[model samples]
Target: MISSNMNVTFENLSDITDDLVIGDQVFTSRLMLGTGKYRNLGVAKQSIECSQTSIITVAIRRLQSSSNFQPNNLLNMLDWKSIWLLPNTAGCTTAEDAIKIATLGHEICKKMGQEYNSFVKLEVIPDSKYLLPDPIGTLKAAEYLISKNYTVLPYIYPDPMLAKQLEELGCATVMPLGSPIGSGQGLQNLENIQIIIENASVPVVVDAGIGTASDAVKAMEIGASAVLVNSAIAQAKFPQLMAKAINLGVHAGRYAYLAERMKKLSRAMPSSPSIGFPN
Candidate 1:
C-alpha cells in the first residue's frame, strides 16, 4: 500500500537529516572516540574504525611525549584524511598549561595534513582525585581559545548555568561530564544534564563516565547531541566489539529521539479499546 513518493522520501531521509555541525565542520556520526588508554595503537585504530566516528580526540601531551620513543605512534596509525582530529588538553592543570597544549595540538593537526582544523577539546582539570574539570580554569581557557579562533569544546561538570555561559562565550560545544572521568558510573547527574540540554544553544556533548552501550543510549535518549567515550571502550575485553555495540546504541538512541517517543502516563492504559471489544 506504499506510494512511490513515500518510498523515495524514506530512501532520501539520510541525505536530509542527522548531520552534526560544530563550528565549521559537519559530521554524520554523533559518537566521538578518545584515542587514549587503548591496549595498543592497532586496537585504538580498529576501535576508531569500528565505531565509525568522524571525530577522534587525541591527548596532545601524551602523543608528544610518547611519539618520540614509541615505535607504533598514534599519529602515524590513524588515517588522518577520513578522521578529523579533536586534540585534547588532558594532562593540563591550569589555563596556561591547557592553552599551551592546545596550541601544540593545533600544530600537530596541521602536520597531520589537517591544516584548516583548529578544533581543541579544552580540559583544565586541576583536581587530581576525581579528575574533574575546573570550571573557572576551563572558562578562562575557553575564553582565550575562542579569542584565538580555536573551536573550543570544553569538558565540565553538569552545570546548566555554566553551560549557558560557555555557549554565550562562543564555544562550539559544551561537554558536560556524566560522572567522574573513567569511573564507568554512567549519567550520575541526569537532572543537571537535562537542564543543560534544555538551555544550551550549542551542541551539548555528554562526555566521560559512560560504562556501556546502555549508558550511551541513555545519554542520547535524554537529548544529548553527542557522547565522547574512552575508558569504557578502551578497557573492554573486546574493544572493537564494544565500539560497534556502542555505535549501534548511539544510532538507535538518535533515531528514537527523532521519532518522537510517546508520552508517559501516570497510570497504565490497555492497548485494546474497551468499548470496541464485545465480551
Candidate 2:
C-alpha cells in the first residue's frame, strides 16, 4: 500500500472515503503523524517511512540565538521536501503570537522549498498543564491565518459549534480534539466529533487523544475526513512497529468507511434456534 513494497489487504467495510484535499494538496492517506519525541532521528524517519504519513507535524519554538551558544548549532533534521512539513505553533499563548509564528513558519517553509502552499497548525494553548486549547485565542488566530492566504488547520476542543465557526472563518480543515493532547483517551468526545464531522464542509481531522488503531477507525466510522495522531505511536516502545499498526489502522478505517459499516444489532438472530437449524 505504501511505495509498492507493502503487501496489504483490506477487510472492514463502510461508505466514507479518506481522500482529503487541502488547498492544492491532495492526500490519499488519512493518517497524519507528528515528527517529534522519537528515540532518535533515524528511528523517527523509520517510523514515518513505515507509517506512510501524508502530513507530518513539527513544533517550532523561539531560540535564544544570541544567548548561550551559537545559533548555528540548532538542528532540524527532517527533510522538508520529502513530506508536507506542517509547522505548528505548539506553545503560542496568544493570537498575536500565533499569527507571527505562523507567518514566519510560512516564509521559512518557502525558503526550504516546501512551497507557499503549506499548512500551519494554529495551536494557541494557554495552559501548559492540561494542554487545553484557548478557544478565544484560537479563533482570533484562525481569522488572521485565514486572511494571510495560509491554509489553516486549527486544533480545538470538541465543540461542534466552534468547529463550525472555524470552518466559517475560511479554515481548510477543523481539527477537533479526540481527547486531550497526549491523553490517549481515544474518541472520548465521540458525540461532539460526530456532530462536527456531520456539519463540516471542510475536512474534519481528529486531532488529538487517539490511543490505538481502533480509535482511528472509530473516528472514521463516524465520517471524519482524517485523523491526526502523534504520541500514541511516537511514544511506543517500538515506534516503527506502532507506526505500521497505525498505518494499517488508518487504511482499515478508510476502507471500512468506503465499504459501509454493518447495521447495529437489536435482537439476536440466533444461528441455531428453535425455528430454523442447519442440521
Candidate 3:
C-alpha cells in the first residue's frame, strides 16, 4: 500500500507544490508505467519498483488470456495497497468492444480488492498498422463509460478539439498520444499537444511513443500532467535501468516546467553590457 512514507522525497526541489489529481485520487508520482511487453513478470515488477511509479496500467484482455492467471499470478504478486491499477481497454476496436472490456476491467479491479476503483484507460484502436486510436469510437466509448460512472482516461490522437470534447464529457484525463503506440518515435505532435494542454481544464497525460528519457522529459517540460510508458522500457536491453532513467527525466522535466524557462531570441546578444567593457 502506498502510504505517506512511500512518497518520493524531492530534496532541494521544493517548487512542486501540488499533487497529480485524477478524479478523487491524488498521485505523488507523475510517471505511470505499463505492465506489458516485459521479458518476464519479475522484470516488470522490478521495473515498476525502480520507476517509483504509483500507477500501473494493465491490459485487461491480455491479463485474461495469460496462463499466469493462477493463485500466484501477476495480480497477486503486486502490492495493490500502494499501487493504483489502471485497467486499460486494449485490443478493443469498436465502442461496444471497448465498453465491454472496460466493464471487465472494473471487475478485475474489484477482484483485486479495489471495489471503488472505476478508472479505465479507454482505447479504441481500429488501425492495426499504426495503432492509432479512432476518434469517433473513442468519443462514443468515453461517453458510455462516463455515464456508467467510470473514471475514463481516453487515449487519442493529438487533436485539441477531440481532447476538449473528451474533457467536457467528464473524462478524468485526456491522454494524447505522443506518437504511435510502441513506435518509440517520441513526441511527433508537439504543437497539437501544446494546444491540448493549454486549452484543457483536466490533466493531459502524454501516452505512447516515448523512446528515451529525453522524450519523457520533453513531455513533462511541456506541461504534461503525466506519461504512460511501456515498450520503451520493456523493450530496452536493460529495462530496470531505463525505468530509473525515465523516472529521473520525469522529475527533471516537471521541475523545469515549474521553474519556468527562458525566452527565445532571434539573434545572439552579448552576455556582458557593452558600456561596462573597456573600449
Which model scores highest in TM-score? 1
List CA RMSD, all candidates. Answer: 3.9, 5.3, 4.2
Model 1 clashes, total count: 0
In model 2, residue pairs whose N, Cα or C atoms come closer than 3 Å (at least 3 residues apart or on different chains), thus clashing, are 13-256, 13-260, 14-256, 14-257, 14-258, 14-259, 14-260, 15-257, 15-260, 16-257
Ranking by lDDT: 3, 1, 2
> Against the unseen true structure, what C-alpha lDDT does each candidate score?
0.89, 0.79, 0.91
**What does the lDDT come to for candidate 3?**
0.91
Q: Which stretches of candidate 1 lie over 4 Å from their true place?
A: 1-8, 11-16, 65-71
lDDT string, candidate 1, 1-279, tens digits: 111112224566665357788998988789999977899878988999999999999888876764443546777777888889999999899999999999999988888899999999999988899898899999999999999999999999998889999999999999999999999999999999999988887889999999999999999888889999999999999999999999999988876776668999999999877996668
Candidate 2 accuracy as TM-score: 0.85
Please state the error at residue 47 of candidate 2 in Å. 0.4
Clashing pairs in 3: 1-81, 1-82, 2-82
Give the worst 10-residue stretch by lDDT in candidate 3: 1-10
Cα TM-score per model: 0.92, 0.85, 0.92
Superior candidate under lDDT, 1 versus 3: 3
